[model samples]
Target chain A: MNPKFYRSHVLICTGTGCVSSGSNNIKSRLTAKLEESGLQDEVKVVETGCHGFCEKGPIVIVYPEGVFYCQVEADDINEIVEEHLLKGRVVERLLYTELGTEKKIPAYSEIDFYKKQHRIVLANCGRINPESIKEYIAVGGYEACGKALTEMTPEEVIAEVKKSGLRGRGGAGFPTGLKWEFTRQTPGDKKYVICNADEGDPGAFMDRSLLEGDPHRIIEGMIIAAYAIGADEGYIYVRAEYPLAIRRLEIALEQAREYGFLGENIFGSGFNFDLKIKKGAGAFVCGEETALMASIEGKRGMPRPKPPFPSVSGLWGKPTNINNVETFGNVPDIIRNGADAYRAIGTEKSTGTKVFALTGKINNTGLVEVPMGMTLREIIYDIGGGVSNGGKLKAVQIGGPSGGCIPADLLDLPIDYESLQEAGAMMGSGGMVVMDETTCMVDVARFFLQFTQSESCGKCTPCREGTKRMLEILDRICSGEGREGDLELLEELGDHIVSTSLCQLGGSAPNPVLSTLKYFREEYEAHIKDKRCPANVCAGMSAAYVIDPETCIGCTACTRVCPTGAISGERKQPHVINSQLCISCGACAEKCPVGAIAQG
Target chain B: MKSLEELRKLRAELEKELAARNSEGKPKIIIGMGTCGIAAGAREILQAVLQELEKRNLDVITTQTGCIGMCEQEPLLDVELPGKERITYGKVTPKDVERIIVEHVVNGNVVEDLAIARLEEGGI
Candidate 1:
């Protein structure tokens, strides 16, 4: 009997979010307190990865008891040690309460935010120590890699992936199995497998979190992918911005090598496979496969015209297969769990799960992985806890900056590749930015158009010039300088750009503008015809502010915050605005406690 | 690490260790300190718990974790004894620390009213 055997396990999140909020210091304090109290041997401390809800970082969870504690600091460690650890008492005042709930929900799965989520790619995230290979193996991690190498053949592996009906989770819904099969079939002496971790979507963190939380899973996935395609060497092209994810990957790779998973003949089967990391130098367009290959090649990181697809000739002119991080992450599970289990999860056409980064005005904004067939309403209202601050949902911006804004009417649309495409929105890497009623659709289009316009590689004239022209028209319309035929001209130019663009970046750039125009034409009409921004989001469209005499209390708060000093009044009397001097900044409106300051 | 047989043997060995670790025979306490937990003052609550325990000169194991996606009822904590059902207490403050220790940890009695969740015999 081991007396030193710990009875309690404490899991603290060492994910980037929690670490930023000083979780490391909190952890050290806990360790010190445990040592001081002579209770060090009974408790085991483990630092796991992100628990998805980053808003309440510096999080802590205790096992068996299943208690949840958030935002722990060094200052709070003493009381926690005294009351909870020493006395075996739970602190009553600091319990997490929502909607004034009387009871604490200790289990992580039963929480409202996770009630609807089906985590597949995110299975080990926040559950295991990302840096520990033993912890990874404890949760049936590398068994897939072992299973693939020992039990299955190269062709059999690809066949199983195909039978699973898994599609590429990267923007394009290309079949993963087919991509592997193409590279496998193509005649080549040496081949390569690449994991596209260049997740450039602005409002997305799914790939970054996946890499950070479970790096071994990805390594296993890539190893399986490499084995399937008969590829010996691999590269994971991760963005330079994701330093935490990168560091974890480096650690995981070294561990995998030590564990005899990477860089050798696996299980004495004579199949050789290994990998290297290529850091992307911050180009959004490099997310494209050709551009990514070009970057890896130490070239200018530009997309070339595809006649010989990457499968036939890629990365030093060898047969290659590229799949997104999430796509590859799903592969190991498919092989281990069997094709039928993966197939049964989602709809007939689209199988397996999709990890979405849910950001923007929605409540419970976090990383959510749902089966492919789940409706937008379920994602927004059920899992997301509806719009934040009691606001009405206006639209959901799917994909990246270039993805479409699906209106509230289309919330019933199933979140799959084909359905989203049919609805004029590409499921481009699962960046879902929710919008409230206050968001101006015209301005959103303009914002996306500006992003696309600036990121154009200038390889094609239509994408370069056409996106700029569309951006100019959108800017003019937002600035209340629109002509009658501006919208029509934008439509015409947008169509031309989509058809003629060389790469996917230039091609999909107009989707935001087109989708917004298709869904919210009335808002555009208001901007052009009535000279009014209905959502009141556009700055120049609505250019005046006035003090509502009935609502005003002559509060000096607004006067103090007002940059132009346009507001003036005596104490206890209604304030008057100097209209000539007012900059229409709406700072006073924000500063006013009452509904006194009105902007138009 | 090299062969399938070795892998299976290691699996069995690790499984035994896991079983030993999970076999419930002592009191345990878990806390939800995910980002949601932190925002709800879980840190202060955690610290307060430690202080209270030290004052009583008792022994316990306190740990924290990321959000279990319960943003609404965050800063949640759970208490379990050697054989007692796991009881979850919600909206806990430092003020409620002593009673939780006295009524629950020492007496093996669950602070039922403060509990949000429990492992009931019949069903959840």
Candidate 2:
């Protein structure tokens, strides 16, 4: 440490969110102002990756004090440097207000969003400079790889991981250690280890953030796995959509090779393990380990039958092991902190922290890493600050298209493999999207079905044809062409698809439809029986919004904003909406001065 | 960096240097100059803070960072005493800077009204 250097460090997030919002200007302005005041040497400025608080980007974090700032501008840098940096006085206006709190400006943990979170995979995300190998080394990034390769035998490494009780994070919840053991025992001349970075879930971004924020951690994990499974080569199958993650991974690979962590004679232990990055074609089905391996082998991405399950036959028909980016990211922590330490964090069944991307109608929409078995209610109301716009929460859709929609009543459902499975939801890459009362449950089901239907590779007879038939039923019901037995038909198709599917993609394809049917059958009944959308959100619903005669106070307020001029009335008189002219745009309802508009 | 033994030695040395930098003996302050705070008039509040501290001849380090995910309550500030729990203040004005310094910094008392977030559990 240089004696003339700054006594404090200010980290600004230049991640995609902050950069687009002008965090670069904030950095330069902060530096320029500090240099002018002769305090540049006393204060160091570093730009880091995404802090997961993208909603309040242009985030600034001052270390030692650890005061968090959000939505910063170039104009605010001068004040921050002058007031908070120089005078030993905090600038009250720049502090972040804890979500869901009445008055307290939460420190990082006090923020309910972060209180339940336990950082393991995201241990160094916003804390260190990913581009700097030395910064990573300072925080024990590659120490796990060293420990695994040098001291621990291959069997000892596997045993430690098995004891950690970490299940797969890629929705399946398979044991990571068991997978490695299967591959190790499989007879093969050249075994392979592949990191499944093809995160294709609709709202999922945890894998992308992990890969971008700490690429070395994943590389270290892969290296340690190679040493454990006695593999010589590894491949990282990442989705091409994530350019930033891909770039960082590439940079990290080059740096690791330079540092003698990769290539021949790693740590001088003579365990030569090399890695290659393969950009995926953005196929959702390729997220399945089999399909991902097939894609890596220069073939079409499609799911194949298991039992010979990657462990026995994978990636050019060799004994290969596959794990998601998040699963591998946890390996380093488990190695560094020991299995018992990791096992102590979560429930008996599910161990360690799970990173969740909290999005949709929640107030504090970002990424949160909470321990396993936290209730949905705490994650939503306490951490996510309930629904945005002061609307009541209708339901939370977790685990993407293959996962299930947990209703508002089951808000206390503990988030774990067994608990979530019983609730008809799976932890699919940790996408927890909180939906509000305005969100139509039927439409949500239809939207998920549509995503799955399009992403289906059509290799299996059940999912390929079953999803099409179910989607057609959903379309008819949504467009006001519903019959009495359409719901039953959907249930039957879901059961058949789950039973007869060839792969997990085919097997779990009916989750959205089945879950929505089981939990929200009332909404479907209303759509069919009353021909009305209770939320009035569906476009083709028969419900027409009308102004009540008793409530309409002769106000022509709705007449002006009506795009189609469907509302007609004179000044100081009750207005009527012509059903023919109304496009059901809800403009008159929105423009109504009184709470008179009703939809039924 | 080549072997495990060398790597462990480097880690110890680096950790020592890092620890020395964060001795907890020096007073520090931070401003939440993120997008939300900036939009909520934190720039001026920050200026007032600097002017107040400068007027009092108080020496401390100040810095800015992105949002802490609490955009609703922008214009945030956190004060760190050597060994004491960090006290965060919210919705501060140029006028509140003096009271925070006089009461909290000088007299070892926290202004409860302005004190918002406490940073004892998770500092960074």
Candidate 3:
């Protein structure tokens, strides 16, 4: 044992959010202060992963007291070292205050954002130093891998996973154990296991955080999966955009190799497994399994028909088992603690937890892992602290561009795989973007279609042509040039694309348009019929701005600020805006002294 | 590296290093590290106490405090378990650190030979 102990441990978040906010400087400054105060031996500084309260980044937490500090700057390091680390008095100004209340929360666990979260996948994310494999081992990291390899047979491992009701968390809710069983039972001289860390969904960073925070956990999960499925070689297909995740994963793999966790070894049980990382060139379609396999095989990343699924003929024409990063992250926990323990956490069907990257117009924008079947309301209001800027929530865009928009009326809906699919949204690798009343639903549909349309691999006609057509109609609608029956045309095209597309990329591409049309159809109608955007987001289609003469003070604020010089009035007199010259910029409306602007 | 025993040994070896990071609700051993206490050799006592806890694999929080107006017994050590009254040992040398941790922190028995004062249920 090292036999070294510190009175206090200061864990500074070095996750991407915190690093971008200059946490590295704060860390160095803190180290310098500790050395200056001669408390270097007594106070240990640890760099951790994302704390998930990223809206207040540069988070610092001192253990033995668990004082939670947020938005810490380099200058604040002196106060933390002097007041908290030295004198044992918490710096009151740096504590995380409750969203609506003035009460300061010092402890990390007691915060409302972290209290509602059940962190199984993200258990070690912000708690440990990610760079140290020793810290990972001390937290019981690879014990499950050792247990699976040394004690249990491959059949027993697969049986336990099956009994746990573990499903694939990579958007599709396929049973993971069944996939493993297929790959294990297949006849092949050599087999392969691929971890799909190529998370390409817009607004989703669950896999990146897991890879950056606990790369060893994912590697351990892969080792167990490889042993279960009788695979000797594995590859992690992560996108190249995630440099930090890749670096951490590289470090972890080297450390695991050094510890005999990887390579032809096996606690002397005679099993051989090694992994290599394949970086995808940032293609959204490569997230699909076949496309990912094709990319790994040094071919163009495009999906082929299934039926001869990866379990039968996968990478390099061998039997392969592919699972998502999060799906694999759950394996070690399920094996260590029995299947019943894993099944007990979530609903009967969707067992265990799901990690969602909560973003958009929410008060707390970060990552959150909640148990399956948790209500959207609980995730949005209880954990996310409701919509941002006290705005009314209009809808939530779940599952990325391939997913759908859920209206405010469905806020109480329990978020399970089946329920999300029933609401026309697949639980897409867990991206929950809350939209406020100021958001235009028609534009939201257009935004997602634009993303999917641009990311389409163009392998099939339905996805290529169909998405183009839908996006064109959406474009026309938002630009105030929409014709009647455009909504019906979009629905027909969406159904055709969903039914005829070759891969899931094309199949689910029209989800945003179809789901938004299903829920907020009236908004689309208003765009076409009234020639107006109710939310005033579409600059071309927004209702014309007019000065309310009765309330206009003619303070000349509007006239001086208007770029078009449309407002004409005298001092203390009512102003009149030239409608033709107004341009609907709303600058005059914002600049008006009195409440005198109206959309006419 | 070839067997489960190796992994377990590795885990056991590093477990004590992380014990200090998770010391909520655990018994606390506070060493008076004030200027006067440091002059009386309090830093050595803190090191000895931490080493003993690590050797025995105990979960205890060790902290430092300024002097409490008892410079005569400068190197003071206080042990306060959860819901237990605080026990302070005065004039503590590096040699007495292990016995105090074993008796007061682990076994819940105060060392009578080094008895000094008893505070209320709460800790500083």
Instruction: Say which candidate scores most in lDDT.
Output: 3
Write model 3 residue lDDT over B13-108, tens digit each, in one string: 887778877876789988786678878998788778867876777878977777788989978999998888888899998889888888878889
lDDT of 2 at A522: 94
User: Which number leads on DockQ?
Assistant: 3
Question: On DockQ, who's better, 1 or 2?
Answer: 2
- List clash counts for every candidate, in order: 63, 30, 0
Q: Candidate order by DockQ, highest to lowest?
A: 3, 2, 1
What is residue A276's positional error in candidate 3, in angstroms? 0.3
Candidate 2 accuracy as TM-score: 0.84
True contacts kept of each: 0.18, 0.24, 0.55
lDDT, each prediction: 0.83, 0.82, 0.90
Question: In candidate 2, what are the lDDT values of residues A1-600, reduced to their tens digit?
Answer: 322234467888866667889988999898889899876655678767778888888888876567788788888887777667754456677777765445545255565556667788887887776776766887876899998888898899999999999899988899999888988988778999999999988888889888878899999999988999999999999989888889988989999998889999887788899999999989899998888988888899988888788888898999999998999999999998899999999899999889899999999888888889889988888777789999898889999988999999998888999998998989988898888888888889999899989989999878999999999988888887889999999999999999998888878889988998999999999988887777777885856678898788877878888888878877777778888777688777887778899763
Better of 1 and 3 by DockQ: 3
lDDT of 1 by residue, A1-600 (tens): 212334456778988888999989988998998899766865667788888877666778765455677667778778776766544455554544443255666556567667788999998888778888777776777788888898889999999999999999997899989999999999988999999999887888888988999999999999999998899999999999999999999999999888888877888778889999999988988998999999999998889999699999998999999999999889889998999999999899899999998889987777889999999999988888788999999999998776898999999999999999988888899999899989999998888888878888888999988998899899889988888998899899989998998899989999999999999999999999988888987776776789988988887888898788888999989988897787678898998898888874
Model 1 spans > 4 angstroms off: A1-4, A92-95, A99-103, A547-562, A565-581, A587-600, B16-124
lDDT of 1 at A472: 86
Give the 10-residue window scoring lowest on summed lDDT in candidate 2 chain A.
A1-10
